[model samples]
Target: MADSAPDRYVLLLVPSAIRCQCRCVVSHRAGRTDSRLAARCAAVASVGAAVIHFAMSPTHWNDWMPSGVFFAAIAAFQLVWGLLAWWRANGLLLVAGVAANVGSAALWVMSRTVGAPFGPHAGEPEAVEAAGISVLLLQCYVVMGAGWALYRRCRAEEVSAIGRSLVLLGATSIMAVAVTVGLASGLQGHHHGVEAEAGHGPTTDEHLGDHHDEEPTAPGEGAGAQTFDHHSESSVVPGIVVVQPPAAPAAPPAPDDGGHQHDHHD
Candidate 1:
């Protein structure tokens, strides 16, 4: 009876132990899957940001060489990093990804708000454009995904309210469109506003042409010429005036002229 009782107890504990082990295994697999998904999300976002940077690099090159080179370097780094992350994610890669994206995003915000600290266009606040905003959004997703992958506790909630991959695809499309528009518009800093200002203020040659198209107030009037109109007998032109003498007071008006016709012939 004692042996049977001990046997029964051992059997009961064995099943319980098996169930616990199964649960642990399932939990671990679930965590691994979630991390993989997070890594994929980060990779997609990073690549999207890289595309935007690549698209903008040429335009920035036109504005400033250093800026263009910086953008190109960033794009290349992000592209390689994203590819690596997608293949296999580790703690170091996740941390580096987060740091790079955050720093870039912060720089963008600073340039937009307080203006760039150094450059030919220094001290000039860059206007917020669709492309810039799109990049910011992508970087935000990259940071979130990287953070989630780095910490398992974040897997408690869905990384995205919608499907993560779907959301990333949509965001990537939006960024592509924004970058196209930004390139078409020629960015915001020296392209839009400065060009518009130049357009509004015509050149000296244009001013001369405009003046030529209009009729002048008087003859010999080119610029800075002022003329006054006087009686029909005399003319006042710009810097010169002409006046007719009184004709010796009209010969005293011919002494009332009614007595007789006194004519003077000359």
Candidate 2:
């Protein structure tokens, strides 16, 4: 029997902060001071990660980023943030979350407007959809939305922070739907523009340039003259080929006399 290779194990060292957070982010994975709030935070943050995962793909790497790399970053950030939120809202994490969301939203708008840094992603629908979601969650829901809710929760007892979270979710959902419609409309407009450009471009009316043109009917020309007009046509090429019939072979030259010709006697 052949000898089997020994098994080997490899371990990768992760940062303390990330290690701590990872344990916290999983639902019911660890003991938290407030389990209810932790679960809710984890759910939202995990959903953000899932949304980004749906938007991005590993295979989407190209000269132009397939919008996947950007979303991957967001997913990573959300996971970390969710873990932190489970334990408590550390001011640093809150600030980082807000910054990440705002920066991403700005970058998304820039990409759509002028495609800075990475140029553009071949007008991909998936890319556009990803950008729209980023706007909905990070920009609209997290930064603009959750911040205010958290503040209100601190200020008053009448409104529950849960209500704010629900409102934020609703807003994000509405934004997603609206953006989807807008994206469809914009794509349709662009397609029509492309069709118009194709229909009327300088290349569309093109004709083969190499030609032989005959002169207009001459004053004395008859219908038969027109029949022979082909021979007189003006050609782009000055040279013309002429074909002639092969000549009949001449009778073999009168056999050469053998030097003496007999005179005929009368």
Candidate 3:
């Protein structure tokens, strides 16, 4: 009977090996699908963030912070999903990915406010601001691309769709940067012009006032000089009167004398 027990143990080992191989194959297939789902979910989260950033103006951090946190959470979820996928639970990974994306979308919606903190003038043309936003948008694209690549490695489907999505996101991000930079530049120019005009305006007013005062002083000085001239001339000719009427008086006296002589001769 002891010899027979050894034979039975060998028979059991054969069956165990066959079962192990079957389990391995199943696990590998499940892992492949799970990894693909995780990657796709991550890509969707990244694309959503980009859209939120673009559509909103004066994007505020108060609301944006939650979205950022949501992004981090999605990444964590994807890691877990990848692990589950490795363990042959593809369904769990799919569920987790979908849940994460939903959370991300909700966060984006909550962040939308009626007015932007920067008062519609945020993200204007200072090179540093434009450059910072551009870098941020680029990072989003990079993360999405990385996720898509990983997904393709796992699933091997829809290569064209992945490429197209990447291209579209990149182009949109570039256009957004261009528009932001242009607006900022225009605002800066307007501000500078207003400052310059304000600075020069006071100086012009001051100069004009000085000229006006000088003009009044000139007229005052002329009037004083004229008074002095008139006073001097009047003092020089105070009571002088010149007349030449003596010749007329002498003709009147000769007429009276001739009339008396003619009366005596008649």
Instruction: Give the 10-residue window scoring lowest on summed lDDT in candidate 3.
Output: 186-195
Two-way TM-score contest, 1 vs 2, winner: 1
lDDT of 3 at 133: 44
Off by over 4 Å in 2: 1-46, 63-68, 118-138, 153-266
- What alpha-carbon RMSD in Å does predicted model 2 have with respect to the real structure? 21.4
Count residue pairs with overlapping backbones in model 1: 0
Candidate 2's error at 105, in angstroms? 0.4
lDDT of every predicted structure (CA atoms): 0.72, 0.47, 0.42
Which pairs of residues collide in candidate 1?
none
Estimated TM-score for each candidate: 0.57, 0.40, 0.25
The order of the candidates by lDDT, greatest first, is 1, 2, 3
Give the per-residue lDDT of model 1 (tens digit) for 155-183. Answer: 43334434655755765675566556645
Q: Report the lDDT of model 2 for residue 203.
A: 46
Error of 3 at 69 (Å): 6.6
Tens-place lDDT digits, model 3, residues 131-242: 2343244344434534444554434433345664565465555546644664453234222111234343567778766554432233324333322232244454434332
Clash count, one per candidate: 0, 0, 2
